[model samples]
Target chain A: MTALQLDTKPNWFMANWQQLAGFGLPVLAIAIYIGDDIVEGGARLFLQRLFDGLDNGAIYAVVAVALVLIFKATTLINFAQGELAMFGSFLAYVGAVTLGLDDVKVGPIPLGLLLSIVVAMVISAAIGAGIERVLIRPFDPSDHLPVVLITLGLFLILNSLAAFVWNVNPREFPSLFPARNESGAQNFVEIAGARLFYDVIGTYIVLAAIGLALYFILQRTKIGLAFRAVSSNTESARLVGVRVGRVLGFGWALASAFGTLGGALVAPKLFLKPDMMALLLIFSFAAATVGGLDSLIGAIVGGLSIGLIQSVLVGYLGDNDSAFIILSLAVAFVVILGVLWTKPAGLFGTSAVERV
Target chain B: MKAGSDLAASPEALWSEVEAAADAGWPQWVRTLNRTVLVAAGLLLLILPFLVESIALRRNASLLVLSLGVLGLVVATGKAGLISLGHGAFVGLGAFAMGAFVDLVGLPYPLALTASFVTCCLFGWLLGLIALRVKGIYLALITMGLAVVFPSVAKRFPSITGGTSGRPIENTLDAPAWTGLTDSQTIAVRYYFCLVVCIAVFALTRNLLRGRIGRAMQAVRDGETAAAAFGVSIVRLKAGAFGYSAGLAGTAGALQVVLFPFVSHEQFNVFLSFRLYAAAVLGGIGAIIGAIYGVIAIVIVPTLNDIAGGLIRNDGRGLLDNDVIVFGVGLILLTFVSPDGFAGLVQRVGRRFSNRP
Candidate 1:
């Protein structure tokens, strides 16, 4: 079995100078290109853009982490991850909005919405696990075509199912965090004249909590050991008496939970829709690829880098033209190409050795 | 398993088996039956336009064009063992290029078609170059990115693409005076034109796949190291397959312009790419017949959805006949039942029938 040396560390700048330069050069060029505006407005505009980018980066990181989890465990990319997350958001919507669970309370605490969201996440996780067992486990892992096809199929089915069930109309999803005070002043902390919304802060805190929970689960739990063992080598893990199938399913469940959280966090901003996650999927893929598909920490870094690049570069380039509204997507595509070209294994991923 | 062993032991023997199975292995009666079936199908296709409504003809033209796109997937993913989730982008590129050349360059329809074909081939070749260092899931990621990014890029050029609303190209491939068809009646002419082009492309593809190049592609697909050891240039083979596949997709795009005379960025969204992949799989990857079946399934399923959707339309809300759901279910079922696809299913049936004698 090939060991990934997940704990072994390389100097960040030394290991990823090429990637840094690639992302940095673009931001520099874009900054120079829009120098006049930056000079006139000072660093306020730039700081605002950076904050916005980081806010978006947090969402991508959440989704990218989900992607990395599955990749680490099964060596397969779940193309349907975004849709699964989107579906989870819909479930949350049905619970909190349609069913009016948000109005329910427990002794001076309105935790009903939170409870509903957790329930939605649990349902989505179960679905994810079932998908692994029923659809994925039967296939030979070495043959990638079936897995790819299956995931792509699931992507389409889940997306369409969401559309059918919820219809295509955009729905307003209430933010998890307070948007405004009773006096109607926006609830945000201003840093350098840039308003960092409470929702964004809430998202980060939730992500940190998730990271901590995952850390405990993986480090201290028995299933975590099994999952790590299976991810490293299914054959070896099986030989060592690890329930590889259950561990793989657990990985899927964890991934789906994270994905649901991402979808719910971003829905308030993007507006809940069937196709809301479509573009986000591309961004998260770029994030995952940049971070190394199998590295959790890498996904976070990649997501932030991509988000910053997309926001700043696209913001500057599309300054003069409304036609370039979706230029961020193009930036994501370019980032994927650039990262894969210079470093195929990504910034932190272990390079795989293919056998003849 | 036996075929794998045969391929490993002797490439020549496997090559002959592939070549002669349809011709020499089948009995004379079976061959005659196949011939009769082919002749009947061809004749039916020829007369189909006359019998069907213009809308049906239009749908048939769409089916034929989609088949070409599916065939491209069959060539690249099926035959050459390269996974491309972005052929939809190539198809869109061809459509937009055809629109541009014909409208802006003032070129003839044939010239426009040729130009679109060349443009897509070059574009695919360039993408293939960028992807030279990557393969497998990474390649799929890149291609899918291309698909996702293509529409936004296309929309940037408002003049050429007409921005978000899309532009309509002038209909230049109208029926000749000899055909004595009215303007409205020209639908048949368009259908026939697409039909003819489709047949030619299919024939060329069949020839290409059955020859030496196809064998080399299969070899690369089966084992890159072995193929390289046997002196195949992996780089050239992969790039050529991509270019060729893109060319086929481009031709399909040109035909689409012929049928609809409209090009839009919205039409080339990522779902289009996914649907193409789904159709390619459901029809059976790598099989020409499978592509046809796939196109049939894709085209018919939507119409069926509409019909079923209308009947089951509760308060005009729950559209149970959604094509996406059908395709999703179809792809999953096909994968579980037989990854070889409908084409494989047909082959199994044929084997059952032929083995009896």
Candidate 2:
């Protein structure tokens, strides 16, 4: 009896064998290639790549969530999301660098960078809500053409406007976390011979905080209930006495604020530039598509997976060059195509139902 | 009754007889005057290249090339309701492929042009297959991705695309030796070459869009499910429209190579795609002649910019001074004011005038 019990497979595994195989096959393939790196350069190099991938993945996740939020409520992909994020980052630049707030202190806390980022996010949120109200609300939602044109036009306007304001030059953005200690030592913690920077930790913490804030706002608040109601069914929500327009504005505001956070996190690494978010937008789009356009959890998973694939797969296959970046983009494009072909609704999204 | 039957047998005669009956509405003099103006305009176009400066001639040729590009977008987005934001990629592919065929494979100019069109058509078909799986805005997203990724991909292939620096074709599209044309005369010859191709493509497009396929496409655009119920294959109609549209853009790119003899990856960025879409919207995407007007409207931006620059006594490179900004403003304004674009406005005015009489 004891031998039989020990030999028997788990029930969950038995029930989900097909799903396990489907997921495991790709994971095995990825592991095989990564295993090659582990053998050649030891676990240190593997850890380094993993750490870097996760760091970038955090930023991708934020942007993907922003995209998903808008898609959930409106069924419209904001083509200008990345541009708005880039503009928000510039506002941070204006707050911190231009206004000389980078070194300022408030009470016992070093709150300058935090204040600037928060201010930028708030302003971006307001702008986003205003856009939904003025530019987007006037158009018929069923007809997608005008809205698409408007968003795309906004994309162009915001991009060139930033370029005109900042000139096409790249500027160094102050990091939220200190890069060096008082003793002139690098600020990082060594874990298994891989140094994890404070910025990466800070990014993750802020991401968690934002996630919690969003969760509470969505699950515990009246407005959040209205937002969820509208996102699920606009007509039903309207029938139930919800102010659908204001709820949608709130949704846009949240999406924009999240995008600003993503921009602020990535700015230190990517540098603040007019078009910094362009390629990142493509990656985020792939992430959103792969995870399911309307699913928050899917966005997070998709974003991380894309970041890992780009960093690990492309990193192993190609060297750090322009060619490497192009290869990563190609991989993302292929991923988008593959996902759309196989599962249009994505892993987490509900499949669309068309009534004939 | 016999005279009425005879008049009905000849439709033009019947139309004229009806026009005589309704004499206050549309006069015979007005019809003749319209025909005269059209003929004079055609004659002016034929002679204007020789009369204008070489720069102006080249500009006109490029404008024709741009019209082809806009027409390509009009075909897909206007007719089929497939919004493609990455047609610039198709144009780029055509330009690069044209250069490759002519320079590397040593193909003749006409053959190279044909090859470029086929190549771009194939690519468009392939992408359409993937993109058209799930409907509505996914195609736009994918095509925009294509536009964004094209430059990087083109840059990766150094031999064919000349890497980052770009490729300069050997300029083999000169006037034929049999023409015995002088250098200045050759400019007019090039202009005429572009003009002829433009007219040919437009006529062909007009013919194609009036056929069964065009009706099927319109049916699909109007209601996909109803069209499918009516036995129209949505996939084939859509993908074919995409391929044909791409072919037009490729031909335009081939023409651009002919006009300028250069192909660069950077020239085919997202901005070009945006400008093309903006022009399509501003000029009226639904009408074929709208494409020509769209290109002409975009071409006038620089001249306006120069005038604005002179008035301000500053370099024409300040905020809101760029052509792209104007295009953005135009796209938004057009969407709000005239969703059907300038062609719709013209049609409305025409209708109003015709009704007044």
Candidate 3:
């Protein structure tokens, strides 16, 4: 490791110089290109792109939260976060669709979907705990290489295990949120002459609720304090009588639950499959990277920003065979590189001082 | 125990015995033994396609070629501790270079391969320069992003790379007309071509590692500040490793065109990098000879999956169902149980047989 340098937090505006341009340059370029297209394509297409971007952004943020959870705890990127979530979604799928849990009802409301989600989340939590205990705890967690390798191994295992269990085919998942309102019409609320989807609205509400719940758990709760202590200094926290092992397990569990929930929500729209979240995982990495790796709030904002840029840029690129497919990801990667080059610590990351 | 005691008694006795046994000189005899083994292996490989009688089995060319790419990875990640998760980009760069030089520039096969090597070396050097600015996990992330970017980068240049479809080399070098080889034999010629390249690169890497640059790389990997204090230009040495590794990868990629006949945008996905990583880890990374073991594991993995799948099920599923999962399990288990990997395992075996400490 390079010699660690200490730094007082600089003003956001001061730190923003490189990153602002890193993000803004691409935004400006995309905007100019989109502005050119809007003159010909008009408002409806633009609105659709915005809505799509928001929807994608919301999902990316949700997953990025999961990423931030682990990063906070271990400072290591879990390559299998998506796979683990995909596994959780697969579990939910099994409980709801394969086993017909959705057939059950609690009075007028069907509790089956809710039941499946609860069951899957619990199982996913356990899976996460097991993974940390079995695969991670033994290794030197400070070294990212081993942990990354382990997570990659987990990625492969979970991905192929899902394939083995579910078969390598896409399965339809019921949406947690309804697309239509009570009136049987596609739910839309008009804002600035642009219609918003109820599904999209419901997604936002669910994500916001999750966000609030996370905020409460991280801020207000006792376990959250324990988690923070453990994350900051595992040995010192242990010395101070914190149950570091259990706290680490809890963090992993929470992260996995978030991942599973993110997957369940996304699977409905993208269709449930082992590889469905693979590419999204890459985008989520970008989001996590774009945001400071350690900051939860930064992750959310980064996710939303990346999601918007991706959708808008892709939309602007148009469907020229696989051009959008390749270019969108290429552009995202470039953003990551640009950020790394300009601001190694990231936008919201604690900039460690470099003492020569 | 008695034999061991005899060895403990005198180094002179053993040395004298070895000296007496040598027909030429001690060094010449060892060289002779090495040459003999090489010649025998080469002959066996040359005749393999004829004996196998299956073009599908001959697809081990891909394995050999991929192993060469993994060797490049070892140079960066293992020897230099650079942690490049994006070696596929180097491989892809090389593959595309081969296509451009051979098809576009109309170069001969050898010259085209050299051009591909030189191209990947340049890119690797640039990435290494970036490595100087960033260290540790950050570098890994950057490389990972590069791995993801590579396919699209290749696809963007439709004229050069044939978009997603990829370009195939025309007028491939074939077996001599004198040999009167069959179709499979012609394919086997490609396999031999890969094997020769693999051997050359392996020897080259071995020699580099045995020399001054290799020590400097290891020093840089161990401690950058200390290396700089010792007057080693961290940038030059590190970038040189990157260049060399990428050159190896490029060489592999060039060979891949000969073996596979085409290169696609999809061919050099991030998964390729991961697989190379897995191979390196499994084969005991940083050691050049372990590359063969790594590639062997890679090639044999599918077969193991097939055997398992065949015994377990004969339904509508593919023969190698969830093979990747098995590899995943192998990776996890191998890391936990035998972190040193197959090279360490081999050393243990050799030690056990020889009864050496």
Candidate 4:
């Protein structure tokens, strides 16, 4: 019996082949790229690419989750989600740069940064909820085209509004996690000969904290339960005494806040323009689809993989140029089409059943 | 005695005559009225250039081109219930394809126009075939993704596409000397060229929509399973819808260069697609008149600004400042007030007046 067990293949591998394939493929691609350079000159470049992937992935994940939030609540993809978040980032610009909050400080924190963050979040939450109440609630929710069109209309309105306000010129959004003035404090920590900046580390930590807060609020709170109940089944939740309409409003508000924060995080890197989140929105849409539209964790996985895949493709297959960006998008478009054709439910989403 | 007399009147033949009158014959009065109105409209259109300023006539020609473009969207998004937010690219493809046919392949205007329409239609069919698996929200995203790649691809092929700076087309369409029109009235001749194309294309579209293919599209739009049950090829219908729409858009684009004399990358960007989608919505997706009205909505805005320019600003860009607001808000209001669009409103008013009898 012991001999039979030892000779036999592991059951775990047999049971989790799909998951293993999922993780294995990426690892194999990386290994193939960095073959025989585990400790050589390739290590630093690899590490740097990996870090960049994570940074890009983190931003994509947030935006993807923002999309997932609205999808969860209404089963409608918000085309305007990016624009709404861009609006929030604009609010941040207004609070910090326009309002002179960046110049002042409250103790250790810069007053402008703090004020922008808090105000932008609060106002964004309100705007998101108000939009659901006023604009979305009025439309027939079951028809997908009308809702999508509505969001698209909002996209135009919000985008042009931002441009009208800011004059279409690019503005530098001051980084929230500004590097310390001292050169010694700003020193990069070398990891496997790759230099990691403090901003990247700080950003990762901040994202984690935000994610943690979201997870708890969604998984552990009373309002979270109401939100989930409505998302799962609005009419059924209403039968159970939950205010379905209010939950939807709250759901939208939360989604907008999340998207706003995501846009804010990316604002500095994107240089704050009306079209700042436009390309990122496409990537996030792809990420959301690949991860499974209904799954939160799927969004994160999708983002990270997209980021990694894109960085790797650019590094190996193409150079950093407009043409290369087009190539990357084309590849992403293919991936989306493939996933849609084969597995419409995505990797983690529950398969939707349509009744005739 | 009366019954016997009626029986003598070829009873079977009488019933057949009744059926023919009921279904086939449009009432003579209504037909005559329609012809009269059409004649009047045509006469007015023919003489419109003579009455209006050169700029206004040129704009009218541009409007006609836009109408052709939006007509394609009406078939796809309007008739088939397929939400396409990327038709702007089709317009570009049509324009560029026409340019290529004329300049590179050395074809004349008529052949180039047909080639452009066919090329764009074929593309639409190909993309429609790929999108068979997806439905609803995902379908929209798939189409949007397709739109996103258009500009980049256009930019990549700078040689044929003329890159960022758009290429100028040869002035092949000109007034015949037999018309007694001078060089000063050449713009009127341009208007006539557009009229001929528009009439031919619209007639073709009407014929197609009333036939078996149109019936298939309507069936698919309403209920897919039922249509499939009837042995209708769903893929064919879907592909046909997209292809037809794109074909019309390309035809319009070909004419667009005729009117403007230049085709550029900026003219076919993603935002233009949004504007087209918005135009379809405002025009009433399924109505022919909606396309005309919808194109007019966008075309007339700047004209309105020019009219209101003195009141608002000295620089002549005041109305543009509120363009986004107007378009965005206009779309929302359309959804609320008349989801069927301006054509729907016209139909309602017409009904209300007709009902007074």
Candidate 5:
């Protein structure tokens, strides 16, 4: 068994502006054009593409972070994470319709939003706990595939159950953030002669807040320490007097809560439905992989990067049939190769020893 | 030991005991009951064609293709412990291969079927190689990605694939003059062909599970490391299982194209993969009979929903329209209440009666 190794030394270039500029310049040029049109709307298109990518990336980050939390404690990827989020969104929709919360007369925004969110979170957490107790507890941890199969089974069950209960109608969820007026939306702030969309500004703020809150919780809390301990070695932690089951329960609950928030944030943009998060989950998986599944910070960074790349690709490469697929494949290939080569543990993931 | 001793003394002694019992009881009634069941089965088989309305038969004919698809899943998830989320891609491959062979290469139907099976086997082989590298969740993800990417990949070659709209195959199985049957009768013959093929596949799968290879697969599923120590080539077994699964899925696809006369990427999407998984679990994941039951449930449940919707005049709007919910709820209930699946539950009850006190 090889001992776990931690990187202590940080490169000055990682912090230096000059090095960042050198790396950014080439990316900027590639973002401009390739074998396609270079003259018309190229530069403006590139910036818009970048913003779109960031927005999508922020969504992925939310899902990836939820996945990371569960993975950290359980070392099992909860396949039902996406379904839980979908369920939450469906609940939000249900709240809007049945309770008359979506009505403007109730308030500027529906009263159901708050009630729905709380209910969704509790329900999601209950689901998380129920799965852990019922499906997961019976299986041996070393037997990874059976647990995975159980989760897959859960995934199927949750998706279908949600559909059955709510129906497959796509409901428009009320946005948490108020929509901007037409005049406000049309105008863009000029920055260094480049137009900056205000929506992008709101997205960044939300993403930044999530990132900061996550960092503070993970880095500065006793619960976070316990989480890390459990993640690193469950048996050892148990030997050291940690209630492993409760920790797992908490992990799942935390992940579900995160998923609830994620669903609430993104569901309004896309109409809410049972399978709303199916495609987004794939993107989140890609992000999680790229960010290094074990690293919370890595998930955020990877998600943002993926979002940016996807948006830019869509903008510059055009919405040709093969483009998005090829881009995603390429990204996945790069991440897999990168992990296998320079860092098998991931960019932000801690290097660990494998004992056989 | 007592049972074995009784068995050893059985031929003459058993006959005498049977005679005694027959004298005491109504042996003719037991025989009559068995005969009645047999007669009922025969009559049902004979009357099914006559009873099924033409329109219902048409719908059922198309449903058989999906049933066959679910059967393929039985081999992969049931016997092999491999979860393939890209089975639709294999189905598509087989369908398109059949089309290409029949339309472009000008091959006969039988030869085209063989070509489709062989091509799908090769693709399955490649997928199996990937499965060998990564087990469980990663394997599922890879297979899903393959399914997701298949449509775009198919679209890239529009001339051969017919692009997004998909290609239509000419019906090669027409009513022969010698048969002297009506159009519906000829279609019924095709449906019977599909039913026979499905039954044959199921019987073959049953036999396979009862054989040494089946035991080896079970062992591997239970414990790979232990199986390896027992001299089972883990890689070969898994890959072979995957190949077999792909072949079955491909055959099902070929059958689908024959029945429908049209093939498209839209028919074989990631959602289809999820449905297959749901069906497998609904029927009973590890049992051969479970797959058949699952396929029937998958086909019949939504169909019932549609009927119910029509009767109520609701049009099955909203969630009723989405079969995914039905599949999902069925899966959850099956897992939570009866892990062995609906078929397994039936089998258990049957066993109870068979072993009556």
Candidate 6:
């Protein structure tokens, strides 16, 4: 019976692989057809798309991680996360322009980028802490929906305020990396008959560094332990001498800071506009769900997976505009279906047992 | 449940007090004069087409479609307790069906409308099944996901949906010879048709609220478990309510297509769904009368903003920029101060004055 069961499991796995292969073959064929000109060009295109996906995924990861932190500590989704990030970007713009740091002669690129990031993070953290103290503190956490509504209300208020302050025009944001070629001229270094994009390399390095730093903090810090404790059981954490309120506030602040960094990083790629993050926010929500809303690692994995899927689908398939919308719905449908099919908890979610 | 008892008692006492204080208030003759004035206003509206130019009539005809959309919301969110952020999808479904039938399939406009209504009803039924399993934020999120996903799906079948741009519908309405109306008079005729539809819908909605189904919905909204224990099929009721709401929205979309000359994907974006919620809330969520008031406010706000901007000789851009801020602030203030909305507040104030004795 044991041998039979084992055999069945392997058969099931093989069947799943076969089904995936059936779907993937068409995509592979399309890619090969498009990339037939240059072998290295095909590889370069793949690498570029992958790196771009990682960068985009990293933004989602930061937002999702922020959401998870707040959810863990306070059991709230913080619907205003996107708006907070938007506000942060606006502030970054102000810091660059108002502070006269936009001058090209202001030292080198690294110093200016560091200064702007610091300013953005500080402003973002303050906004996060303020919202937590003023808007969220009065609401009872157990009554979840009303709190969600309040966050939505705040979202509207912040979005409108951002629009009111920064007129609705999409502004050009300065890139963190210097775009000038290393040889003091427009240079394209051909490697294996394909050019290596510098932006892709920079993005990969930054995302990797951020991911490593986050992993270390969660795994090896005292604050991280308290955060986990509060998330697991707030009442127990309080009993065990953890300042639950402070932890939640800290989580919000951290989320805001991460969101600000994401906005800053992505601003150069996309135009910095008040409503720019609206669709991104929806995409992030899909990623968060796919990763399991409460799981940090799941969020990172989910974000990367979604980004990859979105890029590849758009690159090889027809009409890239609908890719995000289609992918988001597909992910949501799968997540919901998976919940019904195997475990209602989710792919990586802890099964929530209600006592009452 | 507590609210029901309050409603039953307060109105009776307020009416009697008004009766007693009538002498001290406005004279009986003056009161009769006021009623006459109100009646005259109604008569004036009925005969407006005879007096006003066709251009104003044409413009105001669009308001009827908006009113119908708000009325649909009154059923879905107000009565049925289903907060659908994607009601526009149903509206789009209805509009697209109407367009396809009347223009492409060579069906009569009225029959096309019926087809639209049926299509929306079916879609609503499907959505309601999902709604039955979720409540509160999850329901809201799911409906939002539907809205976010709908435009892409609509664009997928370019031949049917006309792709991103959209297809135009030829004029289906012709002025009959007996009416003594020209092409210019068609606008007034359509306006009356819309007004009649609105009145009929309002009457039906009011009657529905007073009936057993509305009571069951209210009971479900108040407490699902208790309603279930009382032998109410919560799932069926929810589905019925959603279907009914979708039918109303579809009817509105059909009217919109008829009034306008074209139908497109841009007409049914996610913002439209948000605006529907705003109109419902601004009007008064739970009341039929509130829906009418809400639709008027929603229409008038933007128009008034534009007018004000024009008056000052400022470009309309600033006014447009401030629109979101005003809407956001107004929504927050309305929810905070009068959770029952403007209609409820007006009703309460009217009662307070009537209870002077």
Q: DockQ of each model against the real complex?
A: 0.63, 0.49, 0.42, 0.41, 0.21, 0.24
Docking class of 6: acceptable
> Which TM-score value belongs to model 1?
0.92
Off by over 4 Å in 4: A1-41, A106-111, A179-187, B1-44, B170-189, B308-322, B352-357
lDDT of 3 by residue, B1-357 (tens): 123344344434533433343222224333344456456755766666667755664566677688888888788888888877788888888988888888889898888888889898998898777665777777777787788778877888987778867776676767889999877668877777787888888888988875667766766776666556656798899889988888888888888887766778888887788788888888867566567668768888877877777655434565357566666777888887777577656554544555223
For candidate 3, write residues A69-177 as lDDT tens digits: 9888887888789999999999999899999988787774458987898899999999999989888988887777778778878987777667766777788897766
What TM-score does prediction 3 earn? 0.87
Supply candidate 4's per-residue lDDT for A21.
64
User: By summed lDDT, which 10 consecutive residues of candidate 3 chain A come out lowest?
Assistant: A1-10
Q: Candidate 1, residues A1-356: lDDT per residue as tens digits?
A: 33455433455567878767876786688778878866776687788888778888989999999999999999998989999999999999999999999888676444877887899999999999999999999998877888888899898888878887788899988777775443676678898888787777887787688778878988899999888888888999999999888999999999998999899989988899999998899999999999999888899888888888777667766755553446787778888998898777888999889754
Clashing pairs in 5: A53-A307, A167-B319, A168-B318, A168-B319
Quote the chain B TM-score of every prediction. 0.89, 0.85, 0.83, 0.82, 0.81, 0.83
Clash list (residue pairs), candidate 4:
A101-A112, B283-B290
lDDT of 6 by residue, B36-64 (tens): 64467457658878886887666666765
> Between the candidate structures 1 and 2, which one is better when assessed by TM-score?
1
Q: How much lDDT does candidate 6 score?
A: 0.69
lDDT for each residue of candidate 1 in B132-165, tens digit (9 for 90 to 100): 6788888888999999889889988877888989
Could you give the candidate ranking by DockQ, starting with the highest? Answer: 1, 2, 3, 4, 6, 5
State the TM-score for model 2: 0.89
- Candidate 1, which segments miss by more than 4 Å at Cα? A1-40, A105-110, A180-183, A320-325, B1-38, B177-180, B310-314
Off by over 4 Å in 2: A1-35, A106-110, A180-184, B1-45, B177-185, B310-316
lDDT of each: 0.84, 0.82, 0.77, 0.77, 0.69, 0.69
Order the candidates by lDDT, highest first — what do you get? 1, 2, 3, 4, 5, 6
Q: What TM-score does structure 4 among the candidates reach?
A: 0.86
Give fnat (model 3): 0.57
For each candidate, give the interface RMSD after superposing the true interface residues on Cα.
1.6, 1.5, 2.6, 2.4, 3.9, 3.6
What is residue A273's positional error in candidate 1, in angstroms? Answer: 1.1
Rank all candidate structures by their TM-score, best first, as comma-separated numbers. Answer: 1, 2, 3, 4, 6, 5
For model 3, state the Cα shift of residue A30 in Å: 4.4
The CAPRI class of candidate 3 is acceptable
Weakest ten-residue segment in model 3 chain B by summed lDDT: B21-30
